[model samples]
Target chain A: MQLPFSLQPLFDFLGQFTDGPANALIIVIALIKIALIVGGLLQIIPFIILFERKIISWVQDRPGPNRAGPWGLLHGILDGVKLFFKEEITPKGVDKPLYLLAPGLTVAPAFLALCLVPVGPIIQGAHLDALVSFLRLDPSIIGPGGIISEIPLAITNPNIGILYVLAVTSIGVYGITLAGWSSNNKWSLLGGIRASAQMVSYEITLSLSIIGVVLLAGSLNLYNIIDSQAGGFWHWNVMAQPVAFLLFIIAMFAETNRLPFDLAEAEPELTGGFHTEYSSMRFALFFLGEYINMVIVSAMCVTLFLGGYHGLFPLPWEAIATWITNISPSFAGFYPWVIMASYLIGPMVIVPAKVGFFIFLFIFARATLPRLRYDQLMDLGWKRLLPIGLINLVITSGIIAIDLMVTGNGQVELATKWIIGAITLGLFLAWDLLYYSPRRKAQLEKDYRLYPKSAKKGEKPALAS
Target chain B: MLVDFLKGSALALKHMGNFIIGKGNVTLEYPEVKREQPAFFRGRHRLQRYRDGLERCVGCSLCAAVCPSEAIYLEAAENTDENQVSAGERYAEIYQIHLLRCIFCGFCEEACPENAIVMGASYELAMNKRTDFIAEKDDMLDPAEKGFGDYHEYDPYISHVTPESDKSAKGDPWAVKAEH
Candidate 1:
């Protein structure tokens, strides 16, 4: 089923002026998609900031920004305008070139990585042909008279999608490091150095955690990974590789420089961190980069573990279409359009909803947890998450290898995957409940007994422990 | 560790849920709505007067002497038959209180022998300039029509404690009003 209105007709219309491989038409469509996506992302950043404020405020039992526009909807835009009008201060004896370049470096890579993310399912082949027939146009007019193949929802679907995302996102730290060094301020330099170190340390575990998902999916292309997780929620990599999901999420927090891993920008210790010397719109750019990076990370998490755009229970589009057609023959034309609309719009909606959940989790964690001490942040990343990720990767590969040897196929059966997940989860729970909890309680009791009692009603206790 | 994390998060979620249901919000929406201060609340001071439009203060300087911050200053002048100011022999000729030094300790009110000075329920004492903080005699004095401006007039316990015998004493300024 295909929607009656699609870019196919527009592509065909534009194909008339283009010759030689229809590259011009493809470029035109790609440009339009890019414009829409980038524009949408820019527009969404302010609201995401607003959402963070609102959620944090809510967790603190206060009404958040409710005065700007009904429920403070315009608060984010107003903040942007305020930041735009503020004076940009260039401190003395700073590296002006790197200082100026830092904000751009920070923002550009996140947007670049967004290019490879598959926001919606590909619209192609039969759908495009159906669209052509609906428009009563000759198919040969576009792309050598054949259907224009696939119209991917992504801006650009690179074969090395995950690698590109990892590589591009890692460069965001350079912007922070340069911003810090260029500021010629102690706090900024400290923040920048911390960001670089923290990101570098976590990047290892971050990439390692994803290897489990990559192994399970047997593809590094994000779209293929999503495809492998299709059918149901259980098939999602999160269910198959829970340990990886946990490690990935922890590493992701560090990579994003968010709390409890946000030692880079720890306000009490590092002041404003890497952007301490930044002011006005330059500061806003760093903020924009941070939030957009958050969105990108959330999107990647959704694409990898949360089944991308796949809904938990597949919608009965075909059944609904058939039922509608059965109810009235006159509404027969509405059948395919309904299915096609679902096909086009379903993933677009589902993916954001999943991403929004992750974003909310990010905000929730910030509200619930205190910023980790710098050493603790590094310790968690290097000692805890790194080891867990490596172990998870090895165990996953060993299972896959054994499956290959026994069944002549590398794919672990769904039952085997469930059994592994259950065992991992069970072991974690048992350790926490039976061992860790009792030991912690006994330690607390012993500490309480060791605590000195007050000497008397009016006398002071000794200061010595 | 994970369980503890989950528990902490669950507690936050509980608070958030309560906030959404309008249960846990402690914000007072200040400025638009002012809180009602208790009658005993120590605020800015007010000089009292008698029913016949006579000043309650006899220029004894008890409040000035009792002020821990030395915020109060006053001078006394003898009252004559033609120019009677206070019901007593001496009247306060010049009275002032430096609000900037005042700690709102209610000590001055407690030490007033004539029951002439009392703290009023006006805590909005913010002023723009240093000179503006030096409250003049007229500024602290009650209007002539509203006799005996002791804030204890609103306190049921203190109002009931004024001796009934004092009501019959001639020229006694400590006499409680009949309305009370």
Candidate 2:
């Protein structure tokens, strides 16, 4: 298979080691990488859940779940343990196999999609060569014979990365639908149907919204996408396609079935939704799947719109890496690794910071917004976001076309100014349409004044007028 | 339409921001930080002692009779030369306050003829066993170091006790207030 332009060097470096019996070592490393990603995600979801509760409580001006551990850090962990010990109850006349398969189906794709999420720098073939030469490790051992663990930050960097994410996440719907249908309970069926319908409706907008960034990045590979956003903040897709960023975030909430978009598991209407009949570890799996999905979506958002790992200023990693190399001849083998670490630390920190910002947004939205009625959810997804996504795509493409035309004549300076002007204009127009308008202020005041009795509770009737 | 949505979002953002940046959290981590109880707050009842290390209860059973919840129980016994538990002619041989039934209304304290019992500031009355809720006379009695003067420093009924009978009772602040 053909590798992406950026990854060709790494492939060539690894190619020398992929001889006969040595190939099995690659498999070992691959398995380890997958394990690390899955294990890290499993450990992280509990904390994310805890943070969600803590953030929501803070927003509501309350201290949430402080008793379980220091600042309630162990609350989610204890809840998971409690869920594990709970009796596994399968109600009468359930499709047992499908019911069992539902949770695995839901959770598998959440982890699968994360393989494409780049958390740090991809170590190139040059770095691999440097490490191999300095360490003076056996060529047979280094190649693919013994310890060939030059692991990239991500598990895999498939060419169809974004498409892979889109496909896996959409498949997650089947799990919910199956769980709901097999439960044979009316509420579970309702929740399942609502979930599938909501996911299906929003998936279109979700994918289409992402297309705006895909066009701007000019690539499907997640690494390439982040690479294009390098240099500075303005170069980021968020600054380029701010409309699409907003659209994608809204659609992401629906896709994840988070609050305000969580019509499927609406506790008041459906006791526990699709997992109503599920108990013990089976029920816990669904919870884990939901939180992991949140992490994936937040990571995706960081990669696509927020410049993944790119900090505000240009990081002097190369100079620092060289300085480390010069200082230690004895540790020359480790210098490349040190360089890789220094280079990766920016992205490793910044990307999580970006993901954390979105996660906070998710929790904040949950704390603030009421769940949209099912019909309202559908209307917003189909009638509102779908059209907005298409429009954003067109706008992004038009800007890209103008950019291509202007840059072809070697007048780069003028083209940049034009793009900046256009972005600012678009942002201003969006701000006006969405937030600040005299018409909206007048309407708000009119609504307030219309409710004279309520208004008079805090003010005189004469003053209310 | 979008403007209204954004306006609502702004309101939510403002609320969240104010909560994060402003000191709006009213949550008190209980068991860590306790709230100050008011002066008239009725809580666990304690038996008082006079300055001479004598029990104040005369075994009149008025507190037990007045207890709306019937939480108090006592047995009267003669105070002799060999053993005198109180300044009065009789003493309570067995005094018990059942905390489970105690209403914490201070009525027992109000009905005490000798001002033997007064509601204390200790409100943590949690007990694991049903039997633990029954506080005995010894558990409820104030130690000898705490005298009737310390207990009735502000007692309203202390003035009613004759000055010739109990010296500490006449110097009550409420007694001065009652005269005014």
Query: Residue by residue across A25-56, what tens digits does model 2's lDDT show?
Result: 45655787778667867887789898888777
Best by lDDT: 1
Off by over 4 Å in 1: A1-21, A132-147, A344-348, A409-412, A427-437, A440-465, B38-119, B123-180
Among all candidates shown, the one with the greatest DockQ: 1
lDDT of 1 by residue, A1-465 (tens): 334565555655665677533555677769988997888889888899999999999899998888789889999999999999999999899999999999999999989988987888776666666665665545664422463567778898877889999999999999999999999989999999999999899899889978878877788898899888888898888887887788778888888889888887889997888888889999999999999889899889889888887889767777888888888889887876786777766445787788889899999999999888787787778777776677677777887777667887756677766765665566556655775576787675555454445467777655434
Cand. 2 Cα-lDDT: 0.76
lDDT of 2 by residue, B5-100 (tens): 676777767766776785677788789987655335566877877877888888999999998899899999999999988888998999999999
| Cα deviation of A356, candidate 1, in Å | 1.8
Query: Least lDDT summed over 10 consecutive residues: which range in candidate 1 chain A?
Result: A138-147
Q: In candidate 2, how many clashes are counted? A: 0
Leading candidate by TM-score: 1
The alpha-carbon lDDT assigned to residue A14 of candidate 1 equals: 67
Per-model chain B TM-scores are 0.72, 0.73
Each prediction's TM-score against the native? 0.81, 0.76
